[model samples]
Target: MSFITLFITASMPILKVLLISALGSFLALDSVDILGDIARKHLNKVVFFVFNPALVASNLAKTITYETFLTLWFMPVNVFITFLIGSILGWILTKITKPPKHLKGLVIGACSAGNIGKMPIIIVPAMCKEEGSPFGAVDVCQSYGLAYASLSMALGAILMWSYVYNIIRISSRDVVVEICASPSEGFDDTFKNSSKQPLLPSADYTSITTVNQSSFSSRMQQWLTTSIDKLNLKAILAPSTIGAIVGFVIGMISPFRKFLIGNSAPLHVVEDSAYLVGEAAIPTVTLILGANLLSGLKGSQIQYKIVIGIATIRYILLPLVGIFIVRGVVRAGLQLDPLLQFVLLLQYAVPPAMNIGTMTQLFGRGQSEYSVIMLWTYGLAAVALTLWSTMFLWLVAS
Candidate 1:
């Protein structure tokens, strides 16, 4: 297909995202007050706990088998590479732009993480449905597309909450201490309101009767327990993570696959029920994506140079490197699905992870700055995703 055809096919999905996002933004407006901060928070919880897990598990159960699962070993590596490269670039960006001390983590975190889960979940299947889509029959493409995307979502979540979460936490500690000591920094209202929340969830120290007088063994045990809690291990065991594990079990085990996956199976209703719930994940997420961006418009102290630097790293340079990494692997004799290749490349081009906002909230600073970055990068994402996605389709097809 010509570039125009591919561009049109790619842009269609992005356009849908933009439109729904616009509605989300509109509803979040003060006059509308429908998707305000509290509403978005509760809805986000629903998506995180309920809709997303169901989506991941149901799709994986339907399309994945042990053989196909084995072929996907490269994807997790691909996700890690994106993180590594983005981190390096982000570090370089911080040095060049020299943002405020508190903003360094926000900057680095934004550069390093991409919206690997939500964006792919929305874009991939939509691309498959397009009239000019290169992925072949619509139903087949959509099925396998969801499987690929669900796996990406699962892997991305594990990495983000563990790796990216730490990056923000470590960097934000200084700001947390500063706020605690002074309490007069004149941070934005959101930051001031959330300042009372602990930067890390505090461990109950009641068991330690006297910390200074504690025996070495007792102290060691206390330190170990606090270390585990501070690592935010609970996020690693999130609902989506559990869903992914369940999906893998269903997909890989012959008995589970036979029982739940096919129409002939006596228990296919279970899969159908999960699918019904999972289908809500995509639109709900896209709308929330828009609603979340409204905070960006409220204004903050972020430098435009930093925002531009992040955009360059995420949308331009990262995708270029991805082409080399993905194509190089394929050229060196590893076989991969064309659809998977497209997703790997698309992973590089997505905006920063939306969870960065949550991280900022957790650390009690940079919320305004993160909003500014999200506003610009996501605002730019429509054009960036369309063009890059078009190129990816053409490259894989050729």
Candidate 2:
């Protein structure tokens, strides 16, 4: 395809996201009152807990087999590298910009977690349907493309829930601690002074020292317990994670796979139902994403430098690094299909995951800042993705 043609083809899906998100933003307005804060919150809960898991489980169960899994083994590794490199870059950004403590994780997450799910799911198939796609026949390309997209969604969800989730969770907890500690500082000093008073005559210095040591040890243990509790492993192993696990089990285990997945299977109806529900996941998520972006328009105290730093890392640096990494892998003698290689390369160039907004809503911290970041990254994605897709297609096809 000509560069112009490729750019146009690539821009279409991104335009769709932009349009839908705009609708959501409009609906969220008080005058519209369609996707109000309460409605968006409830819809987000449904997406997070229900639609997303069903979508992941159904897609994974339908598409993944042990053979296909082995063939696509590099995908997970590629995704990990994206997260790893983006995270390192995010940390550097944090050190340089010094955003508020609560926003540090949001920044890191925005840097690290690409929009692996929806972008590919929408863009790749659309590209396949275009006139000059390099990925061969339309039906075959779409089939393979959707499979790749599905796997990306599943793995991305798992990582987003676990890695990104924890980073934001810990950062939010730190905010909580700071808020709580500020008011108690004077009380804490008074308590410390009283404790420093001379002990009763009956209590010898040796005995007092032993009591202090024991009390210190107990406090340490209690602190550890509190920290562990705050980790909230339940949030990490969210419904989406559980769904992915179930999908993998059904996908990889022959008997289970036979029982639930194929059309000929006795219980295929259940899988079909799940698939039907899963279809709603993308539109729902995009709508909520738009509504969240409205929050960004309300204005925030988030620094412009931090926003620019995130945009630069995600759009400029990550994509360049991805090209090098994918080429390096090929040079190292691990052959990949042209389409698969393109997908891997494109993975590095996507905007931040929409799930970050959902997570911020869940934690009730950094929502406005995250929304602003999302608005900027996604707004820029139309041009960035078009340009990158054109280059990637040229490179891969050549």
- Indicate which candidate wins on TM-score: 1
Model 1, total clashes: 0
Pairs in steric clash, model 1: none
Give all candidates' CA lDDT scores.
0.91, 0.85
CA RMSD of all predictions: 9.7, 5.2
- Cα error, candidate 1, residue 24 (Å): 0.6
Model 1, 293-391: lDDT tens digits are 998999887789999999999999999999999999999999998999999999999999999899899889899889999999999998899999999
* lDDT, candidate 1, at 240: 84
Model 2 Cα lDDT, one tens digit per residue, 1-398: 67787667666767787888899888999999999988987897898788878877887777778887787889999999999999999999999999989889999999999999878877787788878788899877876776677778877877887789889988887433245466589789889999998767864878989989999999999999987666656766777767778887898899999999878999999999997887787788778778877777777889999999999999899999999999888889887888888899999999999888878888899988887887888888878998888888888887
Candidate 2 lDDT score at position 182: 61
**TM-scores vs. true structure, each candidate:** 0.89, 0.82
